[model samples]
Target: MKNKSVGIREVAQHAGVSTASISRALNSPESVSPALRLKVDAAIAALGYIPDAAARALSSRRTRTIGAIIPTVDNAMFARGIEALQRYLSLQGYLLLLATSGYDPEVEFRQAQNMVSRGVDGLILRGDTHTEGLRRLLATQRMPFVNVGVYHPDKPYASIGADNEDAAWRATRYLIGLGHTRIAMVAAMSAHNDRASARVAGVRRALKEQGLPLPDDWYYEVHYRLDDARQAARALMARPERPTAVVCGNDVLAYGVLLEVERHGLQVPGDISVMGFDDLEWSRHLRPSLTTMHLPTDEVWTRAGEHLVKQLSGQPCVMHHEVDATLVVRESTAPPRADA
Candidate 1:
């Protein structure tokens, strides 16, 4: 049997505390003494009391829940960041509600509206590009939200993340420095995804700076699936003049390129160099190991969570915080051979 009828007053009576203390313990444990909190906890446990979240929200005008909208939950990089954000919010006595948009602006807007209707205290969004409706909704509601995975200081909204363009530029420069003029790219679909678009732009900027050609034939954009990436690699290899190096959008894409290279009877760095972004855990353990740009995913997401917490708590927070991504060179990339 369940005690669905247990109330705050019953909990206060059991703990030998006033109703005000019970409320404080439930809502703001930090404001109350440890001894008092312990008593309240014990009492609640003994009575099996479950506070009504709706009632609490109505009274406090806060749900203590933060909503996060991400592109996809399948990617390991996003998984790591989401885990970090969830952990940080839990420590701050807040809950994390996550939604995936499949990289669609309309879908993201709908999800944001749903979360806001459900009474989330704040929101954490991915990238700077969002539907105007979503932006207007947040602004109209005065909702506190921060964009993660991209840092744009000039943007009116708050943001905390790495500069995707800069990271990709550095990666392209590394391949160029390795004596590879014939470079190609296997990137994610850039439509409706600012992060992916910025990566493509970065590669172009770096190549243009060196007066290198980035013909339409040299770049292939596909979904983030292994099969898609493998197909793109095949198409790139089938070109009349195959590039000596391929810059992947992320480690997963790089892995697919590596596989396709093996299937084509090629050797990494020996025949074709590969560079990746997002130093995922498996990137380091790949057969030849991946040379990648290491984004501090956990740190960026944790900071985003912290920023939302601060904003909800009426504390000052930086509008834009930039976390740098470092290049990690390993077995997957090297100078191209000179043999004809």
Candidate 2:
């Protein structure tokens, strides 16, 4: 005959504890004494018991899994963060279910609801634009949720991210200090992306502080695609008087801008300076390295995972964890040409 599966009752009996204690140790380890928890763990090991996830969910009313909904993962920035989140969640003995929202609020709501319907224990939403319906659903279900990438502490979910405005401000100020007053910006659409919105504000704030004028044509808005970025850059450069310095929203946009600049036989930094955000992998390898902000994506996602795990385990968790990005100066930025 095949060996029987080691059930919770069997482990409890072997450990000289009630089934309740075993279940408590499994569901909420913080509620159990360390000594008793150790005993339970040893018993589980000796018996080679594997908790049936389905049965455990039935008993504890928890899926022991988290769902994360982000914008597109076409960029490495999002990919790196999601990878870190999955690794951390796995280490904590929980699973991560991910979905992409395509930066659409309605799609976000649908994916969020779908994840919950699949019985996720907690949820992670990106940006600051959680739908009222989604918020109500999470509130009504009493599920723990956190918003990553944008920090809005006064709101319901705990947030983990950098002050995007500050990061952008630093990037812009660096360019201004290089004596490049006519700086152009190549940015993603700011419709619903809080990061994009804050970055735009930061650029504007820095320029206004220095009494620099930002002409209407100096700002180009495009999607995350390089094609769009390339088109935007080409168009911006075609203006009556082109900007000497261009600040791109992210490395992808910066890469496209650089390509456009090179296509026209223009030099980088030597003729026009360029700066990018996100400090992506390829930023350093370019012929003229990129000057950009290094976002702590891995750290941010890891901390968010830990926060959700703690909340799910009945352990105390920090309500909000703020992170900051560092400005990296590289070959892509410099003082404008003397003739300009």
Candidate 3:
């Protein structure tokens, strides 16, 4: 009732080429001339032949597949980066496998173990911090991996990303220059997130340098959910002396803060100024445009993908690459009011 699957020999016969030529064309197209590749491709299409990936991997000892684990795909920033990474990998004749850690180190380690067991050629991880077991497993296997989203050249592993601390410090400095002394922060939970922790540290450093008080109640760490950010902002605003400005760790938190401000009938940059990191697409289109930090998401992820590909291909790549995050000022921040 059904015909058998086409094999390489049939493809070679159809293309009037030897089986070895067909092999070279499929395995390493660059090794053969363009005309030979075209002939093999046409023959393969004519016969509907599908190469056996299992046999090929067994012979080559490489799967030609890469694995990536991110904290969460719910955020637009991570989504955009993952999309870019996948596109780059596909163009390089490799496949991308993805997993989410949900900001949990234990979960991340488990996912890493699973990916390794599946025989991925390399791994791309988010942040430099990882479970000891995960690191040990990778080291035991001598697996090639790179950390994205935060740059730390001093670390043992390869890293490609923005300098979180400096970016946040610059952001805080901008708010300070606007005459906003009473500033608060709605930051992501920093427990397992080195990026968020670094951003918080940067904000603290800037406030300290300027002799501005960073009161205990002024800093709030919540989940990256909009509702959580809204709740944190509501709590901050309920206090007798509300802050004149609020700095958020990322754009999602900033969006939540903006919504809460509107709900409370407060005007942005008038009663309260707000800003964020990761200048997301909708940030610029908001009623009062959001002033935020812009990360080169596509470039960062593409470079991370390139680094892993190079390591797998036996090419030398720099251990660290730092992409700067610049501030994007808009309608949301201004000098604080003289009265009150």
lDDT of each: 0.92, 0.88, 0.91
Off by over 4 Å in 3: 1-4, 12-18, 28-47
Tens digit of lDDT per residue, candidate 1, span 96-181?
99999999999999999999999999999999789899989999999999999998999888889889999999999999999999
Position 339, candidate 3: lDDT: 87
Residue-pair clashes, model 3: 0
Query: TM-scores for all candidates?
Result: 0.94, 0.89, 0.93
Q: Which pairs in model 1 have colliding backbones?
A: none
Ranking by lDDT: 1, 3, 2
Best by TM-score: 1
lDDT of 2: 0.88
Summarize candidate 3's per-residue lDDT along 269-320 as a digit string, tens digits: 8999999999999999998999999999999999999998788767789999
Q: Which residue pairs does candidate 3 place in steric collision?
A: none
